[model samples]
Target: MKILKNILKIFGILGILFFFWAAFVYFSFDKTEFLKTFQSRYSKVLYDRNGELLSVFLNQEDQWHIQAREIPQRLKIAVINYEDRNFYSHKGVDFLALLRALKNNIFLNQRTGASTISMQTIKLWDKKNRTYLNKLNEMIQSFALENHFTKEEILRLYLSNAPYGRNLVGFESAILFYFDKNPKNLTWAQAALLAVLPNQPGLIHLEKNKNLLLKKRDLLLKKLYDKKIIEKDIFELSLKEPLPHFKTHKNIAPHLALKLLSEDKKQVVSSIDKKLQIKFENKALEFAQGLKQKGIQNLAIILADTQTYKILAYVGSQDFYDLENLGQINGARAKRSEGSTLKPFLFALSIDEGLISPKSILLDVPTFFSNFNPQNANKKYYGLISAEEALQKSLNVPFVSLLQNYGYEKFFYKLKYFLDFKDEDYQKYGLSLILGTKELSLEDLTQLYLGLANYGQIADLSFLRDEPLKGLKTMFSKGSAYLTLQSMKNVQRFGLQNYDKTKIVSWKTGTSYGRKDALALGATPRYTLGVWVGNFNAQANANLYGVSIAGDLFFELLSLLDRLDLEFQMPQDLFNIKLDLMSKYRYDERLGGAYTYTLYPKEAKILRTSPFLKRIYEFQGKEVDSKDENFKDAKIQIKLDLPLNALDFLHQENLNFKSEKNIKILYPKQNLNILLARDFDKQKALVVKIANLKNEKVFWYLNQKLIYEGEATSRILDLKPKIYSLFIISESGESDEVRFEVKQ
Candidate 1:
């Protein structure tokens, strides 16, 4: 009895001394150093919105040491049972296991190790020669670590730094490397296999020691089964499972991972939806196969939630491994010609300024703004097209004419607030700005469309899952945005026409000059997506038109995402207005023209009559009012709008237009093509006529030579087969000119 009391008292003294020692170690240990060591090296990991692994960036040593919050409970149990059964009961050192190991090494002449997971974690932090002194140092450090960190945290630190085969430094890395899955997905057999790896990582080579690894893994499973931690059927099934062989980890969302890594972020929880990103990548690759035959080597796509501005999927290129196509370039951030994608914004701005309503008439004829001449895509004018039709057709002449009316400098400043541009870019692009002479990125274009989708509210795009939607500013009025989107809802592109009408899509296509860049940007109520297709080298190809190439892929990707059964809510500020069918402006009953109802902005300027519309009556080749006595036999001819064109020309020429001209040309239309026949009977002389010329005398010049000076309403002159410039000047210094071609 006395010996038992002595033994118990001696152990009590040792236990009290050890407690003080641990307390001293915990207080004296360098916590900052441990923190630095913990944070110094970790494989940058990227996770999708749902916590699925996307990609892992290797550290400087080419090893994957990813930090994780927790491991699978099964894995933790397997590890605890196999490595340290008393892991929870002990402080940091298993004294009984150490004593048993000491007895075996000294008396049984056998080498044994009894380091707990905590001691092994210390060794992993600072690799030192295996000796008694070093082991003692690790034991002291483990005491500090155990006192400072929670049990769960200590377990995490152990697994995060544990070695599992080549270049894999964590259980998370091991699962991803060996099983090609996240740690949370580990099965019973897989968890046991990973748990046994850290003890003998060097012997984990399957070719030579696979049987040895199998035996150890089965033994761990047997222990788990006996302890009731796992069922008998699981142990049997685990024994039947084959060992995992070495295989390369597949990268997910590599381009976006690289982009995030460039900002020096080691871990990223991105806004990407894993399923959506995978679907987009597969579809983009499939879409690129067809484009490759046409020399379009690469393409990129960006899809985002319209309201949140969260980037859901991003494909920087069709294939990241295609070296021949320079597929590594991130096309989403690449700056390329904007093409006609910007025309919708111009349309929206035009509506906001009250310059034109959706159905308002705009001249699509050959237009000259100073030395710059803008032509339609088909190289043929529609005479006069409605503003909605002009936007839907992407007619360059009509948009350029509208921009001219809206003022180029004003549009430039407005766009510069969101799109990337300098002060000099406006002067450089001028009227061609809306025609796609400007350069922008797919990201920028996507953001612009997102703004249009979000009632003209522009905001910065979010890549991280938790990032707040920020930098919102109004780009256009709600009424204007609704009207613009309404105009774009039914574009006549190849695939868009057959789209489901209930879920309307508003989109625009753009082809840069020389077909160097093809782009499409659009928005539904739920999503705003942008697609860019072209060669990375900026090579031009005839097959690179936006509607055919980029737009095709855009619809394919759109179909991949689930469609929402929602409709765009119209802005309350929009109201119905009766517009004259002929003039396409605010209806005036005095004009005696048919009218139709169309939506227009309430705050927008209402044009009672189109600037291009004028009413006149003539009697006996002379101007006459309706009150004139000879009005019964008066001649009626609709004189087209030419005075407005002349005034616009004067503005472009910077000439004074203090007083408007009453005399307007009526014959030999601007940019006319006259075919003079070879036969004299068939050939007719070109006739020149004027309107509203009551008492005004005018001079007619052919190629700068005066041909006629009179107050007559009409004159005839024989012209040669050549390009001729005709000019007319009234007595008040107001002048108009027309360029025509005569062919024999």
Candidate 2:
């Protein structure tokens, strides 16, 4: 009995020790699996919205290793069947298979692998030489891994970490490298081929030993057929499919692909439309070629969905491979001079502030704003221009005046809310901010216009198709945005041909000072596009006019997008209002001017009357009105009948004088002596001419007396020989005077 008790005590001790050893092994896994570390080096890949591959960027290791988000069932099954048939049934280490392998090595004198999928996954982690100690360690970790993860996960880990030849790790990399296809679209033969590659990766080469690889793949397929995993017909057809040939990877949207590449992301399904990207890339190339002859060297374009704020197509440069022109520089993101692209925003703010309506008459004549003089592009101004026409014409004076009246600091602060201004110093830009003193990227300009298309709401553009939008904010009132877009619809187009005018396209063009940059931003109901054309070196070109070059490309791509037929829905917050033609206030017959219709903001108070009453000058039964009532008496009248080029001067003279907006008196220079022929039957009248008129009506006064008031930049004055001072005053109260003596 004592001996029996001794045996029971020894057995109890052994049993307890064994239980603890098993427990130790079960919890000994590294928790963070080896595949996680290996998968971290996956190549960053970009795919279009439709799952088309756009571009691929190699990982830091310079290897093709792309992790599969979801393993294909066929690939999973094929891998398991080929690598470890008992993968699902065994805990981790298949003891029966291990015993068979041991028996084969000892008795049959042949080496065999009995490592299950879990054991193989562990073996891949260390990549150590096969030895008894390493095998034991793998077996221990394999069993622990089974406890840590599901069987499917262990299978996935094996497929992801295993080498599939050609320095490519993971089934995804192999599928993409070998077949140039996504894993989900793999055929049975392709799956079987990839399945057996990891088994003896060193021996199977895609370029060599094709027959051996084929035999192994065929055997796997036969096994799958025998197990009834695939139908007989599929099995036979899969056998006929030839081995995949290595293909050169074609990169589409290379610039955007490089931009979106991140070290942490394995694969990114972007919002880009592959077809649209290719189409625009070609179109941009064509356009860039057309401009290259004119010394213009680069172009960029961006397109996005207005509602979703997802980037649809991005052409960062005309030719990404054109090294001579620095085509690799992504112009879409580079900050260039912003020009008049921001004018719409200023007009929108003006409408929101009730300072002006779309049809409100604004003085476009030359004016000074605290020593800063801004002139129109044509160097001439319209005396009376509607706000919409000013924006359409991209007149600098009107916009600068609007900024001055709107308050410089107010517009500066408001612009910050909509865009990220690189230079935060508001005082540096001042009133020039409305005229593009701020530099912006094509992306920045596009986002601003996209806000207008979205009815005053703005959101950051999204690249990832599945990424949720997070930064949407309101930038303008619905009424103001709608009215702003309405005014932009009829702006002149540069290169548009056979356009369908019924389709409303609201767009604006910009030309940076010095003509170094040309830009266009436009939006339809469905799409928003921004185009930039210029030299990367900032070299000014005569052809780099916003309305001509960039505007042409913008309309071309806009048509290519097939979105021209769509129109924005007018906001209900806008209503039609009648304003007097001259006063731009509530129309009344007493105002004595024709009335016109214009959309007005509902939130703004109605404009009742003209701020300044008009002054009428009546002479010779003809009347002309002046904003200033300090005009000379009508009884001292001079009949004002002026025609173009109808006067001859006694002598031609040149003058140099300082004046606002560079207005100059062309004929009768600064104090000069003029001699007329006394013997002539019909004496030539002393003629006065002016320069830089810009369609503005200038008052011709001889010695402080109004002589002519008509629509002529230069008036023909029929004057007798006399010493006289010629004073020309623009309707905006800017004046230039010169004196000359005419003697016979």
lDDT of each: 0.82, 0.79
- What's the count of clashing pairs in each model shown? 0, 0
Model 1, runs deviating above 4 Å: 1-28, 262-264, 420-424, 495-503, 588-594, 603-609, 615-623, 626-744
Model 1, 1-744: lDDT tens digits are 999999999999999987897677657777678867866788888899988889887887889988876779989999899898889988989999999999999999999889998888888887888988789878988887788877788889889988888888888887877788767778899988878888878776555588888988999999899989888887898899999877787677888999886425778999999999999988988888998888789999999998789999999999887778887899999989989999999998888887888888877654556546677767776766789999999899889988998998899888888764565557988999888877888998998999999988998889999998888999888888998888898788775578655656899999999889999899989999999999889999988888988888988887787774566799888888887777578776665556798888776666446766555677876767778998888876334355544443443345433223566665667887777554475554766655433347888888999988877757877777789888888887767788888887
- What 10-residue stretch in candidate 1 is worst by lDDT? 651-660
Using lDDT, give the best candidate's number: 1
Q: What TM-score would you give candidate 1 relative to the actual structure?
A: 0.83
TM-score of each: 0.83, 0.79
Error of 2 at 283 (Å): 3.1
